[model samples]
Structures are given as structure tokens and as C-alpha cells.
Target: MNTVKIGWIGLGKMGIPMSQHLVKAGYPLNVYNRSKDKEDAFKAQGIGSAASPAELIQHTDVVFVMVSDDKAIDDIFTGENGLLKPEVSGRVIINMSTVSPAISKEMAAKCIAQGNHYLDAPVSGSVKQAEDAALVIMVGGDATAFEQVKPILEKLGKLAMLVGDTGAGNTAKLAINTLLGIVAQGLAETVTLARQNGIDAEALTTLLNNSALGSPLIKIKGEAIVNNNFNAAFALKYIAKDLRLAKDMGADTPLAQTAYKTYQDAEAALGEEDIIAVIKHLG
Candidate 1:
């Protein structure tokens, strides 16, 4: 077992499996979640749970956070009984949530002010990738802090790159999601066009997979479109949110602007469904 004890916060779709890798790696792991049932679920697995973020930090050296949005991130770090509630030092807090770069910078400053290190280490990939520990992690913060946690990060992601200092990971994630939105919109539009011309989705998807545009996303999302499986692996609303974040970051290209509006409009009814569900809106 590694000597550096580990703590985890926010056991959502991604967090649950990502933290499981650490426990499977034999690190003494502890966890906390706003909802008590998630903590109880871990407790059922014989892992310990903390009543609060501050309490969780009491027993662990490094903490990993993987929550939903900017507001959730803010509440986790600054709320009553939050991680920063107690004067803690020398601990590393790795935030893997997809939030704005501005919030990451704010939290990093707060953590550093109190003698702790913070890293904005958002990931690219959804539930399956997280479950398989094949996520691609983009990290930003102190290089030394990154190196200190690289081994641990490797257990959660296939690749972990230290991109830049504090909030760069969030920026890079937004940029990546911008392209992701465009691709999804492109794929949906192509399928819509093909169906309008009386082509089968499966046949079109097979040809596209065999063509120069072939990639894992195209294959998987194509299958989902063919089968009409709009399950929420990565929710549509999140891609909409990421596109909005990218727009706020000054992404105003023709495709960017169009894709943003397309996803945003689709989000009204399809927000809770899989991102590929945007295809349903087209039809």
C-alpha cells in the first residue's frame, strides 16, 4: 500500500469508479459526499467515510474532487464544514471537475493561501473511460505538486499531462469539448442528411467508420444513434455547458457559434439524456 493516504469527494458517475481504482491499487482510501447514501455505499464496501469535507481531510494526505459544476465546486471548498473550514496544510487537493477556469483559479489561490496545493485536473472521456481507468487527464498547477501525485493520477487515467499552471486544465477541457460539440453536431447532421435520402444509419455509420473520419467516438456514438440508445453516458446539458464556457472564452468561429446554438436549443428537452441524443432533435 502507498504511504500517502488518499481522500475523495463527490462520488458521482465519474468519481465512484475513479476512486475505486485507488482503493484497488491498495491505497488506504477515505471518502465524503454531500449525499449520505453515497458515503454509506462506500462504507458497505468496507471503506471508511467522513461526515464532512473537513473531516475527510483530517485523515488523508491528498484529496481528489470530481463533482458536477462551478457552483458545486464552490460549495465543496467554501461552504460551512468545507475542506477549507479547518486550517490544514501540506495536503494536495486535485479537482477533476469540469468547471470554469476562473473558479479553479479562485480555489487554487484559496488553497495556496492556506499552505495547501491545488491542481485543476479535469479529464476527457465519460463514464466508460472512467470505469476502465482509460481517461486522459489534463493537469494544471504547481509542477512539483503534479509530480508528487502523478503516480496516483496514473491509476485513474491512461494519460496525465501537466499542461500549464492553475486553470489551464479547465481551459484545455473547454477547448476539447468545443471540438467535441462540433463533432457531435456534425455526426448528427450527417446522419440526418443520410436518413432524409433514405439511407440506413447502420450502413452510413459502417462506411464512416471505415472511412478517413473513423474514430472511437464516431463508432460508439454511431452505434448509439443506430440503436437509438440515448442513455446518459455524457449528458447533453454538459456539452451545452462546455460549449457555452468555450464561447465565453471567445470561441466565435462559424462552426463554434452554430454548434453552440444547436446544442443549446437541443438541451431544453434532451438535457438529461446522452449527448448523442441531439440526433433525436434533428429528426
Candidate 2:
């Protein structure tokens, strides 16, 4: 069993299952979530809970954060009773949240100055991939620190690669999510076009699945579109947020711009729904 004491600071849809892998791997883990119910849930499962991020870091060597956006990232690491508050040193703080590269760089600098290592290690894949430990993690930070926690990261994802320096993971994530928006929008428009021209949703999806252009995302989102199941696996709003972040990072291509606007327009109505629900906005 890897003996690095672990601390996890988020317990949302993705965070819960991702952290579970650590506990199951016997990493001597402790968790801290803003919601007491989630902490209680982990505690009930024989995992440990801490009252705050500061408290959690006191006893752990490696801390993983998987919150929502940049604001949440700010609050988690620098808010009241945050991780950097306790005068701790040598702790590897890995942020796996989908956030802006700028914020990740800011946090990395702060953590490094305080003698802690910070890695922007955001992941690609949704709740299902997280549950299955099949996520593709893109990491950025100190090489030594990455090698130190590689094994723990492996327990959470099928592939974990260090893409570059401090904010590179978030950069890669934004780029990937920008493509995700473009692809999802394309899929939504294709299904809409086929359905309008007398091709049944299932029939078109089947053809697409067998075609050379097919992919796991196309297959899965195609099924969701066929069944009209708009329930979120990856919420449309998050993708919209990512697109905006990408725009800020200079993703100014025609497809990127169009997809950003498409998702933004859909945000008001279908934002809470699955990203594939962009199809609904078409009508």
C-alpha cells in the first residue's frame, strides 16, 4: 500500500468517486468538503474527514483538489481555513479542477512560495469515467513532485501525463474542452439535420457509429440524443464556462468562436442539462 497520507478537498459529482479510489487503494486518506453531508458520507464509508483544508493538510503529504471553477479553486486554497493557512511545507497540492490556467498559475506560485508543491492536474471525462477510473489526467508542475504522486494519480485515472509547467494542464484542458464543445455542437447539428431529412435518430447514429468518424464520445452522446435523455453527464454550462476560458486564452478560430456562441446561447435554456442537449436548442 502506498503510504502517502492523502487529503481531498472536494466531493461533488466527480470528486466523490475520484477520491473513493484513493481510499480503496489504502492511502490513509482524509477528506474536507464544504458540504457536511458529503463528509459524513465519506466518514460512513470508513474514510476520514477533516474540519477544514488547513486541518486536512496537517496530517497528509499529498492533497488533491477537484472542485468546480476558478472561483471555487480560489476559495478552496485561500479562503477561510484554507490549505495554505497552516504554515505547512512540503505538501504536494494537486488541483484537478477544470479552471483557468491563469488561476492555476497564481495558485502554483503561492503554493511554491510557501514551500508546497502545486500541480494543475485537471482531468478529461465525466462522472462515468471518474467512477470507472478511466479518466485522462493532464498534469503540470514540478517534475519531482509529479513523480512523487504519479502512483496516486494512476489510481484515479487510466492515463496521467505531465504536459508542461505550472499552468499547462489547465491550458490543455481548456483546449480539449473547446474541441469538446465544437464536436458536441457538430454532433447536435448533424443529428438535427438527419432527423429533418427523414433519417431516424437511431438509424443515423448507427451509421455514424460504424463510420470512420465515430468515437467514444460520439457513440455515447449519440445514444443520449437518440433516447432524448437530457440528463447531465457533463453539464452544458460547464462546457460553456470552458469555452469562455478558452476564448480568454486566445482560441479565436472560426469553429471555436461559433461553438462558443452556440453553447453560450444554449446556456440559458439547457445549461443544466447534458451537453448533448445542445440539440434541443436547435429547435
Tens digits of per-residue lDDT for model 1, 95-205: 999898999999999999999999999999999999999999999999999999999999999999999999999999999999999998899999999999999999999
Candidate 2 residue-wise lDDT, 110-190, digit = tens = 998999999999999999999999999999899999998999999999999999999999999999999999999999899
Off by over 4 Å in 2: none
For residue 267, what is the lDDT in candidate 2? 98
> Which stretch of 10 consecutive residues in model 2 shows the poorest summed lDDT?
38-47
Local distance difference test, per candidate?
0.94, 0.92
92, model 2: CA deviation in Å?
0.1
Screening candidate 1 with a backbone cut-off below 3 angstroms (N, C-alpha, C), the clashing residue pairs are none
